[model samples]
Target: MTAITEALRRLPKVELHCHVEGTMRPSTVVELASKNEIELPTSDPTQLYRYTSLDTFLEIFWLVQSVLGDGDDWARLAYESAVDGAEHGLVYRESFFTPARHLDAGQDLGDIVAGLAEGCVAAEEATGVRIMLIADIDRAYGPGPGLEMVQRLVELRRANAPGTDRVLGIGLDSTELGVDPTDFAPAFELAGRSGLRRTSHQGEVTPPTTIRAGVDVLGCERIDHGLSLLDDPELTQRFVDERIPLTVCPNSNIRIANAYPRLELHPYARMRELGLLATLNTDDPALTDLDLTYEYRSVMDAFGYTWDDMVTIALDGVEGSWLDPTDAGALRARITADADQLASSLATG
Candidate 1:
């Protein structure tokens, strides 16, 4: 690898917008499908991820959800996800999972949470990669299901369930076109009362006004796929002023054809330039066939970002994370030290 690519690979990464189910290895998906006698469209793992549009991709995404038969499957996925992320310089991750989908598939919520929690623990022990879960309510299912999911999470916490504490917050994701953020207000409020952090996927394919509602109505602390915020100068300015972090997945954006059709046209660098707390991520690393290191390198190459700029982005991720004050501070210090060393090496060469 070149010096720049090597340095980018060594930088500590904090990924805030990833899905646990989306992290399933293609091979594992096929293996699990065979073991469970689940019929797949194609037995070849490589053919499973082929998609022409967001709706088509969701078809495969939903299909993979069915292959997970029990808690052990979720645990294995969690462990493998952490190990894969660690290989790409991941230090901390706050991943999302669609509980309603699993519940609809005849899987118990407790088993899902416990298995993922167990896997996260094993991952931390094996790779030192800290993992947290965000239970995402599917927007298409409407607010009733969202409220029920929140209650389930509350019950799990009250019971002191094994993986319950690992769940840090709740999120809104999936098919944002027709769903209004305000529709989920009651659910978000319930989560708030139960002490869960809030975030939403807004402005990916929707208009800028959705972002405003996400903040004003849903009380979202951060936004995912907010590339469309630039359409509204006033709202964009407010986000910049408030330091609302936007987790922009460039590769995912290109794949979904939402914001920018080309990498060079991506708004990630512009968001940074305009002082938005923008962080890079691999939205669905396994599905997209990309990782955090590749994300950093690709963005740098496309935007002509230097190592210093990479450090700034890395620091933004640390600041934007939901980590507690003490832990965030320590992670920031560690990232700073690493950046300093990388800077020194680059200067010498």
Candidate 2:
């Protein structure tokens, strides 16, 4: 690794778009598959991640999700995911866990949340990296199930069930094509009423109108993968004026969605230039063979961003996070202090 890349690796970073299941190690997948009695088409770790499109990627993502047969499996997955991210300088994260399939398979939501909480707490103690959960609604399952999931989540919170406290918000992901964001509005609304923060994956393959629906109809506090927002100048300006956060996963767009043929062609720089609150993240890090540090280095190299530019992006991550004022101030201070030290070391070295 280059000095810059190495330093970037050690720089404290926050991730908001990561999926916990997507962080499962390849070897862990093999073990989990065996434990769950699920058959794999291939045991080769390298070959496992090769995919041509988003749908193909989801097939693999779902396969990974299927491996968690119980709470213990989930705890293991969460623990390893957080630990791996911590190694890459992830100091704080709001990780997504979509349990629709697991729920449909007769697993209790409480068990899943409790298991994830147990694992994340362990990881926090070990790495000093804090993580909170966002329960995502799988759009492929349709609106009814989505609402049901949120209702159950509300019930868990009402009962003060284990791990519900760790779940700070709700989000909608998976299969955006041909699905209306408003269909899940009831779920998002209920979550809002229950004091859950909200966000949704929009514009990855859809248009700006869907992105608008995500914000207006669903009342999402943030938008994930709002790649198509620039397609509508008016909407883009609104996002800029409002400083709405877009959790952008540039490499994932290239590798999974095929939205752009290369990283250099991505609209990330354009988004920033327009003064939109676009934060860098790795949507499915392990699946795409990505980490936040490499993400920083690649964006810097691709867009000719200097260390200061990268630091700005890192700070934007803090601003875009779901952290409250006091906690956010503390995290921003930490990143600033660490960045100052790292920059001094780099200058000297």
Candidate 3:
């Protein structure tokens, strides 16, 4: 209902599992591409994000990264993106940042995180939006580099400048093909030892077993793209029982089309019916030509979710994210109060 749309606007949101570079607006991409002296495939930002398959989408995603050539580019995008996120009512966000995915093919990992952290700091100052980074490894690269990336992220978090939430966790991103998350169990063991939280992408383009492997093996506190969990009722029931959060990305799922395809086909409703912990997000906002609002709105429009259901789902994100408990509680309280007041106001009218 239109009331739900207006109500959703009033309720602040917490984003978990968004891709860093994927948050870069197309206009930002164009500007960065020009400064880096790179030729882009399209002048329009919207069209650039219109890729239909995972393969083509990644090609465009990597090409955008190529246009962002240095630490400054990285910082600029991250900071401004924080501003964009804030304008979209984001109080806190957990970003899955993959430094190696765009590491200039031979750059040091330290340099990558350095620029990103600085940008996160600057973004916080500029917008008051708390941004946390999750250093992610491309699973497509096999277990070797994935472990290396996780180790470096742990070191970076340990070596933080203090007073900020710098790096919060480790994530397994990129295309999960023949790569089963269980294969990298040792890497997660190392990440866990360093006090970094963990999560991974699975069951999006694959099967339900991948979701099980991600949970049972990689030791993920939360599961990303767990759309396949529905295929296995046992897993769905377990997820609902265990209350493990699933970060659902409606627009990105539709864009990738390799996963859940259309927004109507997205399983947020069914997951909700089962009482599973389902959190909505835009996996790649820029690549999907979406923001958190668009993703939530699209899901609401397609699934006919009410404002109350949407608010409840938003709260699920706080529980499932890597945010500190105190912060999570505060955010949940605030959003819950706001939602209640908004609904009450409408009811009275």
Candidate 4:
């Protein structure tokens, strides 16, 4: 590996847009498929992830999610996801887990949360890379189920169920088109009332109006994607003024949504230039054959971002995170000090 690439990989990162289910290793998918008795379209795991568009990708994503038959399966997925990320310099993440299909399949939410929490704890012990959960609502399931999921999550928190403490927030993701962001207000409102932080996927392919609704109506503290926020300069300025974070997964947009013709065409640089807290992330790392290392390196390569610029991006990630002020300050200090030491060593060699 190039020296710069290796250095970038060593830089600490905080990921907010990642889906734990999307991080399942290909081999794990095959094994879980077998264990769960779920038939696969292809026996070869390599061919299992091909997709032509976002809709097609969601089909493959759902198939991957279906492999988790029980808490054990969820634990395995969660364990591997965090460990894999830690290898590539992910220090902390607010990872999303959408259990809509599992819920529809009659799996208890408590079991899923407990399993993920168990896996996270094990992974943390192994790597010292912490991961917290965000119980995401799948937009395809509609607002009723979305509200229901939040209600159940509140119950879990009140009951102090396993892993409930690790669950930091609620988010909305999956199938953004043809879905009204306002329709899920009840769900977000309940999450807010229950003291859960909120975020949502918006403006990936939708307009900036929806992005505005995500914040103003649903009270989202962060906006996932928000790719089209620049389309409305007024709203874009508002996000900048308010310092709202946009967890932009540039490669995922290219690989999954085909939003940009190439990485160079992504608006991440512009987002940064506009002073938006657009943090870098890998939405589905394993599925896209990506790691945080490559995510940072590729952005640096594509946008000609210098080491200092990349450091700024990393710091912005901490700012965008839901970490409490004290934790955030500590992490910011850590990143700054580590980056300084790494830069000094790199300059010598």
**Alpha carbon lDDT of each predicted model:** 0.89, 0.94, 0.79, 0.94
RMSD in Å for all candidates: 1.2, 0.7, 2.3, 0.7
Best by lDDT: 4
Task: Decide which is better by TM-score, 3 or 4.
Answer: 4
Candidate 1 lDDT, 147-222, residue by residue in tens: 8889889998999988999999999988877778899999999888889999999988889999998888888899
lDDT of 2 by residue, 324-348 (tens): 9999999999999999999999999
* Tens digit per residue, CA lDDT, model 4, 200-254: 9999989999999999999999999999999999999999999999999999999
Of 2 and 4, the candidate ahead on lDDT is 4
Off by over 4 Å in 1: none
Q: Give the TM-score of candidate 1.
A: 0.97
* Residue pairs clashing, model 3: none
Candidate 4 worst ten-residue window by lDDT = 2-11
Candidate 2: deviation at residue 108, Å?
Answer: 0.4
Error of 1 at 6 (Å): 1.7
| RMSD from true fold, candidate 3 | 2.3
- Each candidate structure's TM-score, on Cα atoms with residue i matched to residue i, is 0.97, 0.99, 0.92, 0.99
Off by over 4 Å in 4: none
